[model samples]
Target: MPAVTVDNILTLPRIETPALTAVDRPVRTVTTAPTGYEGEGFPVHRAFAGIDMGALDPFIHMDQMGEINYAPGEPKGTPWHPHRGFETVTYMIDGIMEHQDSNGGGGTIGGGDTQWMTAGGGILHIETPPEHLVMSGGLFHGVQLWVNLPRSDKMAAPRYQDITGNKVALLSSQDGGALVRVIAGEVAAHQGPGSTYTPIALSHTTIAPGASLTLPWNPEYNALVYVLAGQGTVGVERRPIRSGQTVVFGKGDTLTVAAADTQDSRSQSLEVFVMGGKPLREPVAMAGPFVMNTRAEVIEAFEDFQAGRLGSIPAAHESL
Candidate 1:
């Protein structure tokens, strides 16, 4: 989905094949994401549904926001909301979204762009399709990932980072059979642009039919691979997986995925979102919008939000 691409993958840096000593991660579980609607009635796939919180430590939630083609006047986005104790990473593969926050962070991001907002302590923000996009709707596809902050940094000051597509590190599989777009963290000693409060690696990979990609992964981090489009097999055992499915990998130093020899006409290749992070290994208490370490803290967050302690909508965006 056009997050980023090169005319010739062979021109990009390649991820070296794992050494013979590298341990191959085995597939732990493969779960299918259920379809749902998100803000303003936009379609979404609850990418993290049914996955254990412990297995997703450092990652709280994830949503695959539409591969739908919206008709004119049909684009939708989230209303103003408050968040704390985590960061929200919005990566747009297509279409446009405008974001504004109470902390004086605002911007417009389009295809291949990413908005990284750390709602530490607390902040109010809203995401909406740009006016023009709403008036003349088109394809809209993206992913929003909720990354948990360590207890110590849960109350850190808020920050924002606008990472454009060109800023992402682009690499190719050892045989140039796949394109890997690194959005954050290091891949084969090559680092992406986004800074993270938690140690993590996030990448969107496209594998051509019949191709296999083996990625060197951090032994200490837990790995997950979510299929965005087409079909593929995961792990060393080569378990079959398709769109809307997610694979949680067991401990290992390398992760592998291979595309099927054929795919549906709608998707010519297998597209996957791969992410991993060092486990927080701490208690988690979450409410509707706030993630915290205790239920009492979650209640306190709601109280603060209602009391205007989080933040108020900016004057210019009051009409939104």
Candidate 2:
């Protein structure tokens, strides 16, 4: 794939104001699933559909990358690729990943930072560990998620939102035992910096031992919790969950995550990402990198990509 050129650089668009609503949601434990893989590349866990595909509609895939050391000259990142009909969110927890897209957009996201890219119509792009890290060797850790687009907005122009970690709203519990970094949607009165095409909430939460919080969530959306570290219980049933597991919650408006208060010295802080979105529940047609509503639309994506209809990342540009 061609490197994104400096020409036609896209300006950052304004985020639409969110209509915040209050609801008293009931909390309950749902189901839990284990991670499938831990490897050398970007993705260490895959939970595309631990439940049913329809159970997590509008959010097709979830991947946790890194928390590994990449030695100098080792294979470390994804090369050029194409994506259509959805959005990709990359949230960095430890290191930096440089990205370039055909829309003359490219940048680096470091620890406590996020990049949300909408591959609406089509786009070819490359995401990799920064050259310095690849050459010098370093620790890389982060998460990436694929959010599906509704058929109605499948052909919208591609856009990117590169939000620094500081830009993400961080809310703390009354006791200061827990903190939530809202990436999208609303958490209490604090809203995320993300401009989402769908009504969704994505948050990274950390709770100290003995701390707990019950957060209000939209009832219409399906809720998911992926444990990033330590051990904890969720919902009213108090389902026990540990690192490398994902919990799928049934309908309700609120979620409770508690950090275990144990005498064991080895007990660690509990950190998790809680995400939920209203299901599109629409027909889905998917190929390798392209996802469309129909098989024919998928074919059209490939054809357009081949003909350069989507756009091209220039080969020589250094940054956007």
- Candidate with best lDDT: 1
lDDT of 1: 0.94
**Residue 186, candidate 1: how far off, in angstroms?**
1.0
Which runs of model 1 end up more than 4 angstroms from their true locations? none
Clashing residue pairs in candidate 2 (N, C-alpha, C atoms within 3 angstroms): 3-313, 3-314, 4-313, 4-314, 5-314
Of candidate 2, the 10-residue stretch with the lowest lDDT total is 1-10
- Expressed as tens digits, the lDDT of each residue in 1-320 for candidate 1 is 77789899999998987899999999999999999998889999999999999999889999999999999999999999999999999999889999989999989998889999999999999999988999999999999999999999999999999999999999999898999999999877789999998999999999999999999999989999999999989987999999999899999999999999999898999999999999999899998889999999999999999999999998877886
Runs of candidate 2 exceeding 4 Å displacement: 1-40, 262-267, 317-320
Summing lDDT over every window of 10 consecutive residues in candidate 1, give the lowest-scoring window: 311-320
- Compute the lDDT for candidate 2: 0.75
Give lDDT tens digits, candidate 2, residues 177-209: 667788998875568999999788899887778
User: Clash number for model 2?
Assistant: 5
